[model samples]
Target: MHAHFYAIVNQHAGNYRGYKIWQQIQEYMIQKDVRLSVLLSAYPGAPEDLAYDLASSLPDKESDVVVLAFGGDGTLHEVLNGLIEAKRHFPLPLAYIPAGSGNDFARGAGLKSASHWKQGLLDLLQTTHAQVINIGSYQLQENQPRRFFMNSFGIGFDGSVLKRANQSSYKNLLNHVGLGAISYLIAAVFTIFQTKGFPAKIHGLDLTKSYAKAYLMIVTNHPYFGGGIKVAPDAKLHESNLKFVLFQRHHLGQIIFDMLAIIFGGFQYHMKAVDNTLLTHDFTIEVNSGQTAQVDGKSIDQENYRVHFSKSSYPFWLPETINKKR
Candidate 1:
């Protein structure tokens, strides 16, 4: 039986690689006799709009329906949130093609670049295997709309770094040449000097704590962050809990050293300066006003927020071949 494949391509991702990859995937799908429909995301929230429309229009046939996101983690993040918001009773397996800077989701899932992505995706569609992963949801204030994330969320230092990188002119060019991770490092150097710790309170899982100078807090659903840095080595996608890595105020020299250590896989040596906490089910973090936050690489304006995490309602399709090797 032929399958229905919906491809949401982010044209601006990966320095113009999205269009080329989409064309290649289209040719391959046509040759395999699969029914394919393509949608190009023209702006920031376009994927969410496309995903909502596609989910609402799903046919009642017995054939399979797959949604493929072609972009970075942020693109997939938007698509996943849209799917959840659609509130469809039927299952829709989601696929991703990495075409953005800092494709951490792809990296953690053992997926490679588009060198052989066509064949890999074809294999994924042919297999019946799908992985049910956890999703992170957050609301900045009371009665506000909630947002979901699949990778990780950051407040303070990391958020500031992402904000800087987004404003930098070299990010796209660096991504084009396979040096996207360097962009984060460059931004970190500048952000670290300017970033200051803010007052915050954490209440969750039978524990309560307050910090006067919380430099950064990273809540992770997966192990990788900041372009392949293993911030939480024990994190797994199937886990129901979230891993929190809090970096407190430290000397500039120590902060720089730890940053380099994370990049070089020496984070274990700097454990004394960082606090690692595991949160089950839900938590609330109250931060001082005017602090920035980020979810899945997109900046958010968060002052006080509550985080609730649980397994996704549906399964995410991953390349079985890649999963086996990992």
Candidate 2:
């Protein structure tokens, strides 16, 4: 059987490096004798729309098609939405080549540098390792239907950071110089200083736990976000559940101290006002009327939204692997 490669390039991603990286991928696939197709996103929202259309059209041929993403987490998020909309199920696999700022998803997958990323992609094609993993889904209370995400989603102060990050002029600078983490750090500090605590009702693995209002609530399928912050330290891709972590309300000094500890991987047990909780499955967050939430870095203004861990609901394709056991 032959393998087909579908490369999606977001020209605006990471200072317009998508096209250049796509060219390199195109050439590499040819060298490997892999069939190739290219999708160039012309503007914002184009990639998601295009991916959905392609998934709907279904390539005429039967050879496996691997969608190689060539941008940051946001680009992958868009592709995931399109694939989900196309009805891709869990068996469907996705590959990444980090070309954008804050390449957190790729970093978590053990593909840190360009050299390592290339090796990982080749391994996916040549090795005997492929596993179906669950992805997270979200839906607002009053908006359209439900949507899906492959990374982290949240509500509250951190959600506000994501919203502002999207609108930041620093994004261009971040993409150009690969300083996405620094940009997020500056924005987060600014956000924490100005944002006030808000009340939220959370229900998941445990509901009786009590505390003051939360700074934010995050549900994740992976361990990293905001570039490299381990938001949900125990999240795994193959798991059928989501990891829930809450930064409960506390004094500014305490919050700052806890955050510093978290940066060093030493804050998990320093529970004072609130615990760094973890959940394995579904969860809900109830906020005052007129609150907002963010899923995969995209913000939605809604009173509340319910997000959960679920198997992929579409027909997705994974790279073929060689077996050594046989």
TM-score of each: 0.92, 0.85
> How many residue pairs clash in all the candidates, one count each?
0, 7
Q: Largest lDDT belongs to which candidate?
A: 1
Candidate 1 deviant stretches above 4 angstroms: 59-63, 302-313, 322-326
Looking at model 1, the pairs that clash are none
Taking all chains together, the TM-score of candidate 2 against the true structure is 0.85
lDDT of 1 by residue, 1-326 (tens): 34577888898887786567768877988887878888999898999999988887876433477888888889999999887777776757788878778888887677766656766676666756566767678766666677788888888888888888887888878977767777887898898788776777788668788888788888888788777777777777767777888877767887777677677774643477787888775787777657778889988875555544433435777765754323
Q: State in Å the error of residue 167, model 2.
A: 2.5
What range of 10 consecutive residues in model 1 has the weakest lDDT sum?
A: 305-314
Against the true structure, whose TM-score is highest? 1
Model 2: CA > 4 A from native: 59-63, 88-92, 113-117, 127-130, 204-211, 276-281, 289-292, 303-326
Clash pairs, candidate 2, are 87-314, 87-315, 88-314, 88-315, 89-314, 89-315, 92-316
Question: Any idea what lDDT model 2 has?
Answer: 0.64
What C-alpha root-mean-square deviation, in Å, does candidate 2 show against the real structure?
A: 3.9
